[model samples]
Target: METTEADGSLREAAGKVQQAAGDLLGDAGVQVSGKARELRAKAQQLYADLASVARESTLERPLTALAIAAGAGFILGLLRAASRQNRD
Candidate 1:
């Protein structure tokens, strides 16, 4: 998670640099790509934060966490089965 945060920060900074350079050069594609990269970094950071929170919550309330996990697994299985049916 620490490594993920570091990588996300680096990517976000790089994206800002790329975005600025693209804007200065009037390259729309580069600007869009840079924006996408920045968003990806932000999403990664958000995911890590959520995971950390979830981890703490699980530690504090193991039973509730287990129930939630089971529910999520069930939902995912349903979705997968539906997806496979559609494919077939």
Candidate 2:
């Protein structure tokens, strides 16, 4: 998790540098690529944060976590079944 956070930070920093270079060179492609990279890094960081929270929650109340997981799985199964029915 720490490694992931560090990597995300590095990626964000690199992206900012890329964006700045693009701006200086007047290149639309580089700018777009850099923006995408920055967004991805942010998303990664967000996921890591969420995962850490979830981990702590699970440790605090494991049965609740299990129930939630089961409910989510059941809902996903139902959704998949409905999609298949529609296709058929």
Best by TM-score: 2
Q: Over the stretch 1-88, how does candidate 2's per-residue lDDT look in tens digits?
A: 5888888999998898898889999999999999999989998888888888999999999999999999999999999999999999
The clash count of every prediction, one per candidate, is: 0, 0
| Model 1, C-alpha of 75: deviation from truth (Å) | 6.0
Flag regions of model 2 displaced more than 4 Å.
77-88
lDDT of predicted model 1: 0.92
Q: 2-65, model 1: which lDDT tens digit per residue?
A: 8888898999998998899899999999999899999999998998888889989999999999
Q: Please give the CA lDDT of all the candidate structures.
A: 0.92, 0.92
